[model samples]
Target: MSNQDSEPEIDNSDLEGNSRSQSSFGDAIEDQEDELGSSESGEQKSVTSDSSEDEEQNEIIRTGAMIQQSKGRKINKNERITPPFITKYELARVIGTRALQISKNSPIYVDPKDSIDPITIAEQEFNENKIPFIIRRYLPNGNFEDWELQELERLD
Candidate 1:
């Protein structure tokens, strides 16, 4: 067969059928909106009541009131400096990072042993608490705290 016979047929009837169906669907939607008492202005009515708006405003006001209450409370300079406790995950991360640094020829804070293993050296430094590292703690509420390792020792 020739290339012309091999080519797919372009049917205008299918296109007409689809356009008719889409117009019918649109008309059905317009009829539904009219039955539902939609206005001529075409602006949709608010599904929520005035009470919902009042509740939202009350929530905002309540949060603001809490902030105002907090402002009245006396601030303790000493209490604000309290350090958070270190977690196991943080300890592992610090040790692993330090070990990687040591492997890359970073200066060791602790006495270097005969062994060349970076992990062993890191463990030694951590155990002796000789590494001058800061413990950073993050809370789920986006609050973060940083403290010197000395603070961890003090807390212990």
Candidate 2:
């Protein structure tokens, strides 16, 4: 027999295996897509329900008087201090700034005692309330209140 007449048989097992894998991969993707679609629909339904409940509560709140009544009558500005006393942060800033001024040969508010240190002198001046400075405290609403150094309540 001639080589042309006696041709070798081709193996298709590898092709069959590849086809099976491709079909399984496609099935997995379809299943995932179906699961995702169902989950998204469930989430949409839950969101709608939650929003409807919120709308009902909002309608009730809108119908009722939502104005908050003040607990106490407003006091005159001169009657009481808003913060009552200077904060530790404010005290530190004042002392540091005054010490800088003292170091620069600025006029000292109080006489230096045993310690001629600028920081010590600034602390003494602060304690004696001799600094003629206004502490401007600002609120979040762009409003500010100015407190005189002597006007603040002292811890000591």
Candidate 3:
């Protein structure tokens, strides 16, 4: 009458609709073996093999003798460079961050208006293209280029 009554009832009715098929290690083992070549024994092995397979599976082989041959693409140094326009996503991110700063009492680089909304001020600065900032562009080769805001036009 004490412990039984104190226990809360659990409702699993919602979980019935969310039931999923049982997952197996077949996919994981196949993926690992494909990425990492079979052991020195020269026969295909499962995930239950010795610790050597496990260690090899953990290490990523980008350039080595053990590197697995894949039909994937190689790095193209002459890949098309990004256009000289600021992407919409980057513009949104910068404006959102600047708006937050303005809301927190940060001084606006542009003139203030009768209304004190930070988002509005940020939008105004963006529309007038007066935001003195740098647009950092990341290349696929792990190098980055900093572009002046004036030099790059807004895509939208």
Candidate with maximal lDDT: 2
- Candidate 2 per-residue lDDT over residues 50-129, each given as its tens digit: 11343342111111122332232323457544676877767777778788888999888687967769999999998887
Q: What C-alpha lDDT, on a 0 to 100 scale, does residue 46 get in candidate 2?
A: 36
Q: How many Å off is the CA of 63 in candidate 1?
A: 28
- Of models 2 and 3, which has the larger lDDT? 2
Residue 68 in candidate 1 has what lDDT? Answer: 32
Candidate 3 has an lDDT of: 0.59
Judged by whole-model lDDT over C-alpha atoms, candidate 2 comes out at 0.62
Angstrom error of the Cα, residue 36, model 3: value is 40
Better of 1 and 3 by lDDT: 3
Q: Write the residue-wise lDDT of candidate 3 on 1-156 in tens digits.
A: 898799998899967654443225324555566556645446765665322443432211121122322322332334536567777777776678768878999767788678688888988887887666555454444444445556668765
- All-Cα superposition RMSD per candidate: 17.2, 21.0, 17.0
Clashing residue pairs in candidate 1 (N, C-alpha, C atoms within 3 angstroms): none
Error of 3 at 12 (Å): 34
Segments in model 3 whose C-alpha atoms lie over 4 Å from true places: 1-80
Error of 1 at 147 (Å): 1.7
lDDT minimum window of 10 residues, candidate 3? 57-66
